[model samples]
Target: MAKTVLVINSGSSSIKYQLVDLESGEGLASGLVEKIGEPSDGHYKHEFNGEKHELEEPIPDHEVGLKRVLGFFEEYGPSLKNSGIVAVGHRVVQGGSVFPKPALVTDKTIAQVKNLAVLAPLHNGPEATGAEVMRALLPDTPQVFVFDSSFFFQLPKYASTYALNKEIADQYHIRRYGAHGTSHEYVGSQVPDLIGKPAEGLKQIVLHIGNGASASAQISGKPVETSMGLTPLEGLVMGGRTGDIDPAVVFHLIRNAHMSVDELDTLFNKHSGLMGMTGHGDMREIHKMIAAGDENAKLALDVYVHRIVGYIGNYAAQMGGVDVITFTAGVGENDEIVRRMVAHKLSPFGVKLDEKKNDTRSKEPRIISEPDSKITLCIIPTNEELSIARQSATIADQGDSYGNTFTK
Candidate 1:
C-alpha cells in the first residue's frame, strides 16, 4: 500500500485539488470546485481513471465547497481511508517573509496565513479557510503549507525592492514576493535534466504563462529575479491583472476617474489585462474572437506578447545572459500562436523556434528550439499539485530524508 498526499490550492473563488501517490508520482484523483459562492453556475469537476464527473450546485462558501469535495471522495473511488492519505498539503499564495520553506500547518500557522491576507487578500483568506475545513473534516490527517513565495523568499534585495520612500516601504513591509513559486521551482529544476546539464551551473528563465503569468530568472536553480513584484499583480500581463502598469495610473483613476481605492483595486486586479483589452480573459476565446476580425482581441494578443517579451529581455539582462528558457502553464503548453509570437520576439536572444516543433503539441515535455539556438527552448507542463504533495511528504517525513516519493 503506497502512501498518498492530498494537495489543495485554494483561491478566492475556487479550489484545485489532487490526491498524489508519493511512491509513483501519480495523481490518483483530481478535481476543481470553482465559481464558489456564486449564485449560479457553480460546480465541481472531478477526474479519475480516465473518467470525468460534474456536479452543478450552489456552493455558498468555502466550507460548503469543501463539504461537497469530501462527499465526492466518498461517492467516488479511492476512499480516503483506503487510499492511505498520510498528509494534506495546501498551496498558500502569501506567507510573508517569515516562511522560507514549507511549514507544517498549526493553529499559529493558520493565524499567520490570515495575518498575511493584507499581502494577498484574494488568496490567503480562502486558503486559510480551506485549511481549517480540511483539518476539521480530516482531523487526524497532518496538514502542511507550501507557500507560493517560498521559492523567491531569498530574492536579491536589489531586484525585490521598489523605488518608493524607503521608510514608508519598510514600515509597510513592501517588497517583491513572487507568486507561482512551486511551478517555477518544479520546472526550473527539470530544465537541467531536459538539457542534459547540471542545474546548479545553469542560467535559466522560466515563463509561466497562464491566466496569471510571470517570468523568473534563475542562477543555479535559485531565483535571483522574477517578474512579479510585491504581489501577483506585478510583472507580465495576465488574464485580468494589469502587470507593470505605471504607478501614476492608480492615482489618475482616483482623481480623474473618481474611482475609490477599492474600485481601483478591483479595476486593476479583476477587470484589467486581457479582460480589459478584449473583454475576454481566456486565450482560447480571445483567439476565436481574433479570427472573427476582432481588432480588440488582436490588440490584446499583441500587448500580451509585448509585455512577456519585455520581462524575458529584462530577465536575460539581469542574469547577464540566459542559457535555457522554458515555457510552461496553460498558454505556454498549448497555444502555438502565442508560443510562436513569444519566441519570434525572442529571436535576438538566440531563441530560434522550430516552426514545426512549435506547432507540434504533446503532453510530454520536449524542446521546441532549433538545433543551433544558443538558448534552449522547451515546453514543460507544470504540475503544481504534485510539487505541493512532494513538499508536504518531505515535511511530514519526520527525520526520514528518504521519503521514497518520486520527486518529479
Candidate 2:
C-alpha cells in the first residue's frame, strides 16, 4: 500500500482536491466539487485511472460536499481507508502573519484562520470551513493548512512594509502579505536544480502568471520582494484586477461617481485589468481580438506585458542581479507571446529568447533562452497540490506532537 496525501483547495463554492502519491510525486486521483451551496443541484466530478465520474445533486454545504467526495473515492477506485492516507492538506489563501508556514489544523488554529478572514473576506472563511468539515469527517487523519501567503511571510521589512502611519499600520497589520506563494516557492525551488546551480546565493525571479498573477524575487530560495502587496489587488495587472492602481481612485469614485466601497471593490477587482480594457480577460481571447486589429486588445496585451517586464527588471535590480528567471502557472507556462515580448523587452539586460526554443510547446521544464544569454530563462510547471502534499506529509510524519511548528 503506497502512502498518499489528500490536498484540498476549498473555494467559496467549490472544493478542488487531489490524492497524491507521497513517493512518486504523482497525483493518483483528482476531482472537483462544484456549485456547492448554490440554488441548483451541486456537481461533483471525480477522476481516477484516467476515468471521470460525475454526480449532480444538491450539496448545501462543504460538509455535505466533502462527504460525497469520500463516498465517491470508495465507490470508484481508491478507497480512502486502504490507500495508506496519512494526512489531509487544506489550502488556506490568507494565513496573514499568523502562519509563516504550513500549520497542523487544530481548534485554536481554525479559529485563528477564521479571525484572519477580515483580511481575505472572500477566501479565508470558506477555506476554514472546508478544514473544519474535513477535520470532523476524518478525525484520524492529520489535517494541515498550507498557506498561499506563507512564502512571503518572512519578506524583508522594507519590502513588506507600506509607508503608512506607524500607529495605524501597526493597529491594522497592514503589510504586503503576497498571495500565490505556494506556486512561487515550488517553482523557485526548482530553478537551482533545473539550472544546475547551487542554491546558496542564487538570485531568481519567479513570474507566476495566471488569471491572478504575481511576481517574486528570491535569494537562496527565500522571498525578498514580491509584486503583490497587502492584498492580491496591489500587484501585476491580472485577468480582471486593476493591480497597481492609485489609491485615490477609490476616493474619487466615492465622491464623484457616488459609488460605495463595495461597488469600487467590484470595479477594481472584477471589472478592471484586461477585461476592463478590452472586455475580455482570457489572454487567448485577447490575442484573437488583437489579430482582428482590436486596439483595446492590443493595448491590453502591451499593458500586461509591460507590467511583467517591469517586475522582472525591478526584481533584478532589487536582488543586485538575477541568475535565473522562470515562468510558471497558466499563462506563464503556455503563453509564448507573453514570454517572447517580455524577453524582447528585457534584451537590454542581456535577456535573449531562442525563437525556436520559445516556440516549442512542452509540459516538461525546459530552457527557452539562448545559451549565451546573461540570465537563464526557463518554463517550470508549478504543482501547488504536490507541494502542499509534500509539506503536509513531512509534518504528519513528525508525530502527534507537531502542532504549530513553522517551517523555517
Candidate 3:
C-alpha cells in the first residue's frame, strides 16, 4: 500500500489543503475554503481526478474548515483508510531562524513558533493556531513544518546583510530572509533536470508571482540573493503589500499627517501596491481594463512589468550573468502578456522567448526560449506543497539528517 501525505496551508481568512500519494507524488484530492468568519455564506471548492465540486457552507473558523476537509477524505478518499497516511506537512509561513528545516511538530515547537508571531504578524499567529487545532483534532498523525524561509538561509553575508550596525543586526536577527522559499527550492532543484546540466554550477533567477510576489537569484544552486528583505513587504510590488517604499515616508506621515504607527503599518501592508496604484489588484481585471483603453490599467501593467524587468536585470548583474531564467506562480506561468513583456525587456541580455511554447500550459516543464537564445527561459509551474510533502516524508521515514539529505 502507498503511504499518503496531507499538506495544509492555513491563512488568515481560509485554509488550503491537498492529499497526495507519496509513492507517486500524485494528488488524490485538493481543495480550499474561503471567507472565514464572514457572512454565514462562504465558498468551499474541492477537486479530485477530473471533477470539481463546490459548497456554499458557512466556515466560521479554521477548525470548522479543517473538519470539512477531513470529511471529504472520509467520503471520497480512495484506498485512503487502507493506505495509512505516514505524515502531515504544513506550510508554516514564518519559521524565523529557530528551526532551519522541516521539523516534526511538537508542543515545544508550537510554542517557539508562537513566540515569533510578532515577526510575522500577518501569518505566523493564525498559522500556529491552525497547527494547534490540527494537533488536537488528529493527535495520532505525525506532522512536520516546512518553512518558507528555509531555502534562503544559504544567502551569503554580503547579499543577506543590511547596511546597519552589526551589533543591532545580530541582536534582532535582522537580514534578508526571503519568502516563498519552498517554491524557490523546488524550481531551483528542477533547473538541472530541465536544462540537462548540474544546477550547482549555474546562476539563475526565479520569479514567483501570484497574489504575493518575490524574486531570488541562485548562485551555484543556492540562494545568493532575493528581493524580499526582513518582511514580505520589501520586494517587488505585490497584490496589496507596498514593496520598496521610501523609509522616510513613514516618518513623514507620522510627523506631517499625524498617523500612528499601527495605522501606517496597515496602510502599507494592506491597502497599497497595485491596489493602491489602481483600484483593482487582480491582473485579469487589469488586463480587461487595459483592453478597454483605461490609461490607469495600462499604467499599472507597465509598472508591474517594469518592476519585474528591473529585478531581472539587477539579479543578473548581481550574479555576474544568468544562465537560466524561470517564471512560476499564477501570473508567471499563465499570463502570456506579462511573460512576453518581461522577456522582451530582457532581450538586451540575450534572453529570447519562443511565443509558440509560452502560449500553452502543462504540468511538464516547457522551454519558452528560442532555440538560439543565449539564456534559457522556462515556464515551470511551482509545486510548493509537493515539495513540503517530500520533505516531511523524508524526515518521517529516514529519522535522521543523513538519511534526509539523500532524498534531496
Candidate 4:
C-alpha cells in the first residue's frame, strides 16, 4: 500500500478535501461538503477512481459534516483504515506571527489557532473546528496545520512592516502576512527545476491569480516582498475585494454615507472588484461582455491588467531584477488574454510572449515566453494540496520534534 496524506481546507460553511498518494503526488480521492449548519439541506460530494457520489442532508456542524465524509470514504472505497494515511493536513488561513510554519496540532496549538481567529475571523475558527473534529475521529493519525501565511512570515522586516504608529501596529500584530502562500511557495519551488537553474541565486515572481489573487517576489527560494498585507483584502483587486484602497474611504463612508463597518466590510469583500465594476466576477463573463461592446467590462479588464502589471514591475525593481515570472491558479493559468495583456505591457522588461504558446493550454507546466525574451514566463499549475501533504508527511515522518523546530 502507498503512503497517503489527507489535506483538508475548511471554510466557515464548507470543507474541501483531498487524499493524495505521497509517493506519486497524485490525489487518489477528493470531495467537498458545503452548507453546513445552513437553514437548507447541506451537501456532500466524494470522488474516487473517476466516479463521483453526492448526498444531501442536514449537516449540523463540522463534526457531523466530517463524519459523513468518513462514511462516504468507507462506502465508496479507499477505506481510511486500510489506506496508509500518514497525516491529516488542515489549511489554516492565519497563523499570525506565532506560527511561522506548519505546526503539529495539539490541544494547545488548537487553542492557539482559535485565538488567532481575530486575524482571520472568517477562516481560522472553522478551520480549527475541522481540525479538532478530525483529531477526535482519527486519534492515531498525525494532524498538521499548514498556514497560508507561513511562507511569507520570514519576509524582510521592511517588506512586512507597515508605515503606521509602532505602538498600535505592534499591539495589533499588523504586518504583511500574505495569503496564497502555499501556492506561491509551491510554484516558486518548481521554477528551479523547470528553468534548469539552481534555487540559490534565482530571482522569481509568482502570480497566483485566482478568485482571490496575490503576487510574491522570491529571491533564492525565499520571499522578499508580497502584495497581500495584514489581511488578504490589502492585496490585488480580487473577484470581489477592493484591494489597496485608501484607509480614508472607510472613515468617509462611515461619516458621510452612514455606512457601518460591517456594511463596508460586506461591500468591499463581497460586492466590489470585478463584480462591482462589471457586475460579473467571472473573467469569462467579463470577456463576453467586452465582446458585446460593454465599456464597463472593457475598462474592468484594463484595470485588472494594469494592477497586475504594476505589481510585476514593482516586484522586479524590489528584487533588483527578476529572472522568471510564473503564472498559476485559475485566472493565471487559463485566461490567456489577461496573460497576453500583462506580458505585452512588459515589453520594456523584454518580456515577449509567444502568442502560439500562450494560446495553447495544458495542465502541465510550460514556458509561454518567446525563446529570446529577456525574462522567462511560465504557466505552472499550483498544487497546494500536494504541497500541504508533502509538508505534513515530512513533519509526521520526523515526529513532533521536526515541527517543534519550525515553531521556535
The C-alpha lDDT values of all candidates are: 0.88, 0.91, 0.83, 0.92
Best by lDDT: 4
Misplaced by over 4 Å in model 1 are 399-408
List model 3 lDDT by residue over 1-30, tens digit each. Answer: 778888888888888888878778788889
Q: Please give, for residues 69-174, the per-residue lDDT of candidate 4 as tens digits.
A: 9988899978988899989999999999998878898888899999999888899999999999999998888889999999999899999999999999999898
TM value for model 2: 0.97
Order the candidate numbers by lDDT, best to worst: 4, 2, 1, 3
| Predicted candidate 2 versus true structure: per-residue lDDT over 272-317, tens digit per residue | 9989998988999999999999998999999999988888888989
Better by lDDT, candidate 3 or 1:
1
Candidate 2: give the clashing pairs. none
Task: Pick out the ten consecutive residues of candidate 1 with the lowest summed lDDT.
Answer: 399-408
Query: Model 3 segments beyond 4 Å from truth?
Result: 400-408
TM accuracy, model 3: 0.93
Itemize residue pairs with steric clashes in candidate 3.
none
Note the residue pairs that clash in candidate 1.
176-230
- How large is the C-alpha RMSD of every model relative to the true structure? 3.4, 2.3, 3.0, 2.0
Q: What are the TM-scores, per candidate, against the unseen true structure? A: 0.94, 0.97, 0.93, 0.97
